[model samples]
Target chain A: MGVNIKNLSILIAAVALAGAWVGQGQADNEVVFPMPTGPLYVKECGSCHTAYAPGLLPARSWQKMMNELDNHFGEDASLDEPDRLAILRMLTDHAADNPNANMLMRRVAASIPRGAAPQRITETQLFRFQHDEVPAHIWKRAKIGSKANCGACHTRANEGRYPEREVRIPR
Target chain B: MMRLLALLFVMTTPAWATTPQQILDSLVQEARQTQSGFTASVSRGEQFYRAKQTGGKEADSCASCHTDNPKAEGRHIKTHKAIEALAPSANKQRFTDPAQVEKWFRRNCREVLGRVCTPQEKADFTAYVLSVK
Candidate 1:
């Protein structure tokens, strides 16, 4: 039994090393690119959530959001003419159509269903679809107050939308 | 030795990597939780399943249209195409993973459950699903 355990341990270590090597390879030529930095998307976008998953919408959608800054989620997540222009320039430069968006952005765009209709931040089908799953008692937990209070579980709301792994629903 | 057991424990937990049962419980729980901010209400998952749309060209709960697997023969009442069931693996083209699980909890909880879900309802519904097989 002792010999078997030792052999198994060695085998596990070898497999772990191999897995790490493969994981490193998967992190290939992906470049660390930045979003077009014109205004203050970090501060401005947080009104709803962070600047949204850039890939959440197409380049056209981002333009629409930026254009209608006055009515952004009923707020003004916009910048001044100079600031807005710089932001726009930055956005357009790094638009979903642009190659600079990260692989995550590009992957999200590709995953969108072919017939999916154009969706806003609030009116998205996926958003609607997901909200349907939660039960009520889960929310009444002393820790949670409201549905829109995404920050209850999603620690990253102040930073942006919930990352899948980051959400830890209250017990 | 303790670390090994801890790792094994996490790996075996259903919540970490959910199955169909866990998903269903989460749904049921969301329906039962009490929330103040909802635009609507749903006390039962079945009731939620039978809800009706408001201010639209037609009115029906999700069950009104998606009676069966959409890919088979269930067609949309409006579009006249095959209706799609909410099954994740069934519609890989739609929900790739559990991340969408939380996403829907937020979106559908409002649409059908009429609010955010409670964790208890999630557990019950998840239990209900485990019993399916």
Candidate 2:
């Protein structure tokens, strides 16, 4: 009975050690902003432009964008009713204003005024502050057509990771 | 067991999988139903493709983003996103899916012409793209 007890204790210790190791690994690999996953969101929205992280905007902004899809940025991007609602749910659930949003996303949400619902992420104060160093002429480059083309400079924008080290302005 | 396996295989296969020719034929049929003697015209399609539209933000045409040559790769006029060639000869996946074909047609026609395209226009446009070698 003593031998069985000792073996059980050893197994418990091993399991505890394994759990700690896994927790440490997760902490080490945690990204600043994890990518949202939705096949319809990528297939429909990503087809035209970068499928921006929903954490970039508040829930109100996403609502407005989804409602005005017919005249989206001077282009017709209207989706079927089901697709529109599904994407809206996905966007609002992960928006910066969402309770489960990360620290940075909360900061982004706090930066905007209470009443204002900015349509473009490029128009946001945080965006301007982040891109203050970039010259105006850089945005006009043929390779980087406009501010909306995040993937032009951010190599892994599609993957939803935008580390400063990954940026490569095209000539 | 063999019959069960065959049933499972058939269930797993997509019923919507179709060829570009099949989609084009259906669009042509719809056009004929709308107009008694409707026939797809490649030259008319080319003219429609190249015409400069006035209603939208800019004087953008189908050629604005798709370019004059359907076989060559094009870029999104604003976003600069690289678009695949429209011609079936250059890109085998051009008109394979009915849903994708309809979605793009609905969006692009409205963006360029300020309205959805008729079945006749869709048929002629498909014929023009399919004709390109």
Candidate 3:
């Protein structure tokens, strides 16, 4: 019976160790943000531009963006009240400032000043800092028209994974 | 026999599924209710699609994003996103849903004309796109 208990303890220790290792692996892969679900969010927002990962902005920024959909940037992206609210919930639930946000998303939220809600993710300090090395003319490339086009270089932008090795700048 | 009939109905008409012709016909019907003797014109739709408007942004028109050729794939002027061809011949999924049809008309018309498109304008635009090969 004592030998069986010892073996059981060893098995439990191995499982705990494996769990910790997996948790560490997840933390290291912080580039992957949570992708928003629902057909409405994808179709309505993605039709015009990239449906950016919700973790790219804070909850407040998303709230501001949702509120001003009638004059979104320079275009009208108005949605029905229910749809707008649904998309808003999806965005805020996974926004950078969300309590359950991952490390990378936490950094995104931390970079922005308190009470400052920026509509454009490209205009964020972290985004600019990350792409600081990229020349101004690179954004004007025919294949990479604007900074808003994250998938132009980050091929896995759609999957919410922006790994450095996966980036491929178009000529 | 009833089960067979139900299956046949489902196979022929999926829920919320629509065709370009059906969508255009419905738009025409709506326009007629608003304006008696209303008739959708392919030529008028072509003109509307090609005409530059001054109400919204400078040089904005349906052609600005959809391109002059509805059969050709277009790119978003600002985001550079690839918009599939608008013509039914080139893209089978152009006007398949009534809701999707209304959504784009509401958005593009406001962007280019700075106002919601009238039922007549929507019908004309559909007629013009359907005429494209």
Candidate 4:
């Protein structure tokens, strides 16, 4: 009986060791998406404006942005083929549908319901609410209120992303 | 010097010091307490975007006709083009009232997750969608 108890303890220790190894291995394989804007994000658009964040949309939105580059908001933000392909790959992979993604992303894709008419789009709801907090003087600025100007205040914009700190409204 | 130190201490405090996960949990619990047909299951945001109606009657989810790939053939209800990826400013008309946001949560949650969304789930979900560029 004494020998059997000792063996059992040894086996338990081995199992725990195996579990730790497996857990560590799993953590390493985890795929984190919409990695912070890379050099291209900064190099390309950052010259004129701040880069937009990748987590801004699921793959679909990125695809749309890529396709419309030829006529991007009256501006030609098109990329060199290699850069375009790379950015698209990154954005789509990090899209909002990914359930295993970070907590901030999961919430965005989950569902926030936009009401009937007057507001059928989700972004509108955000701006409507977000704008409420901003002073009207900011919106009426020399080149503001385009809505795409979200990066105006969300500074990380030019680097292909937006961060809260970049939001310095023109007085 | 003491006043400056006191000001520094106040500034250093975290605004909410809350993890996004905790916020999501709270929203999920809120959905449970409300019982307004909203679901509380938080799915992977990217999966949800590409998520086709797995067990639904028709292939007509925000993903389906919109196409599994949004860039190629997006046909979300309004956008005539291949679906424009979802964005807040892409369309402000998505929501008018706070309650309406809840309504869609209930309906879409059932459509997507096959259930209702909890408040924290919705909040988390909202954060993800809004985060998109």
Candidate 5:
């Protein structure tokens, strides 16, 4: 059993090393949000803005946001009880804590402090760190009116393809 | 046999979407139930749509985000997301779904008026929007 455990550890280490090597230059290239499949989620959340990817935040954040929909980010975004429950289920299922979460989700989960569930993805430390190079004025551009408008710079934001290669800072 | 298939298709197909007219009619019914002889006023609806109110963090009127012209596409002041024209004539999909209509009303009314809108108000608002064409 000791020998088997040693072998498993070595195997995991090799895989991690390989991943690091492949991800070295592509560090800036973020994993795009897989567009949510649920029609209700799309209709309800996407009606106003981009249906922000669920994997971007932990389960706690999703729960907090869903519970306080009446005061959602200064706008009343209340939902019927049944629809709210359905959307919440969808968000929590793909949340950062999911076992098969990608690099972005894993990083987000690691960075958030205990008992602090941020409603906005832009509030996350990782998001700020990733966008530190951007000047504050850039977010105020006519085309890129706000930092929340990911599609303004991320060409395929709606399709969840936010690769750095595709980014085009709109004037 | 062909007639039976057509009948089956009509029976099985669900009308998930309720038209703007249907929504307006339903609102009228609701308004009349509470207030006898209550007729939707397009002018009053227009006033309600453009009226500015306090208590909200950002834009006060439905017109603030929707723009003064319901025929024109509006922008979310904070998020910068493009809102399609509210006029049914300009945007065919506007007010097509019952759930969509209710959801926005529940949110927007609370934001603009700081409370839930009455059925009469909803009817008037719908009538005003529908009249824009």
Candidate 6:
């Protein structure tokens, strides 16, 4: 009876180890947006909000956004010529259509309509599909004002970490 | 001997950090070159800071995002991002860098006033912001 109990305990331990390994493997497969390392990009783009990962949008979307910085969304976000071109280059190099772009970026590229150009990431179908479970009322909470404020719940969002295990929705 | 020591102390003191006054002076100088009699008035600056216009699609005036008080921390009306106080007294790093100051002025003026801010307007705005102690 004692031998059977010991064997059962060993089996449970092995199963737990295998589960942990599988979990780690899954995490590795999940594509995280890479954060920009340039100082100009960090200051100019990140000052107002998270310097959104370039891979989130296709090259055409980025080009459209770059060309219209004077009326970027609702506000003027214009940059000097040299700085603008530099940022544009950086953005296009890592855009969703790039061969080196990750799985998440590829998914974003695939989800968009053939001739449609979207300005906001939240407007994308894939982004909506991923966040469909979240209640609409939760976004109005004072601590988490809008969808743009990703750092509100994604603690490591600034660092480009957005794993499901790290999300902490504020009350 | 004591006077000389005091002078030495003053000279040796690190003046590397750009001050709000220095930036304001430079803006005034730049404004003077274009407008012969340009002189920044605190009252005019304050008025500009508060005035609302029908230019922007989202934000109407500087006050819409920066709030009525420059000394107080403001929030981006749409994004809800917290903007640091604009007053030099409230935030030490307010107008330290020339590039940073120019960047905001360029974008914000277009957004709020529907045009690039003139040197005189920039000077007046700086004067008003600095006076918010």
Find the 10 residues in a row with the least total lDDT in model 1 chain A: A27-36
Better of 1 and 5 by lDDT: 5
Per-residue C-alpha lDDT of model 5 across residues B3-77, encoded as one tens digit per residue = 999999878865545688998988899999999999999999999898888865577888988999999998888
CAPRI level of candidate 2: medium
Ranking by lDDT: 3, 2, 5, 6, 4, 1
Q: Which stretches of candidate 6 lie over 4 Å from their true place?
A: A1-31, B1-17, B34-37
| DockQ (CA atoms), all models | 0.01, 0.63, 0.68, 0.01, 0.60, 0.47
Candidate 1: stretches off by over 4 Å: A1-39, A47-51, A76-78, A90-97, A111-119, A125-132, A136-150, A157-163, B1-133
> What class would a CAPRI assessor give candidate 5's docking?
medium
- Over the stretch B61-122, how does candidate 6's per-residue lDDT look in tens digits? 88988899998888777776677888989988789887789989888887878888999989
lDDT of 4 at B46: 48
Query: Which of candidates 1 and 6 reaches a greater DockQ?
Result: 6
Q: Please tell me what DockQ candidate 2 reaches.
A: 0.63
Query: Candidate 4 on B40-91: residue-level lDDT in tens?
Result: 4325544555555554333335565445433342442221212334444354
Chain A superposition TM-score per model: 0.54, 0.81, 0.88, 0.57, 0.79, 0.81
Q: Which prediction has more favorable DockQ, 1 or 2?
A: 2
lDDT per residue, candidate 1, B38-84, as tens digits?
A: 22222343343444645323324445445623233233343232334
**Which tens-of-lDDT digit does each residue in A1-171 have in candidate 2?**
566988999989999999999886564344345456857777888877887888889999999999999889888898999999999998898898998887677878999999988899999998898899999999999989889999899888877766677899999
Q: Please list the C-alpha lDDT of all candidates, in the order they appear.
A: 0.50, 0.85, 0.88, 0.50, 0.84, 0.83
Interface RMSD score of candidate 5: 1.1
What residue runs in model 5 are displaced by over 4 Å at the alpha carbon? A1-30, B1-17, B55-57
**Candidate 3: which stretches are off by over 4 Å?**
A1-12, A15-30, B1-16
Deviation of model 3 at B48, angstroms: 1.2
Backbone clash pairs for candidate 3 read none
Model 1, C-alpha of B71: deviation from truth (Å): 56
Q: List the candidates' TM-scores in order.
A: 0.37, 0.83, 0.88, 0.37, 0.82, 0.78
Model 4: share of true interface contacts reproduced: 0.00
Poorest 10 consecutive residues of model 3 chain A by lDDT?
A24-33
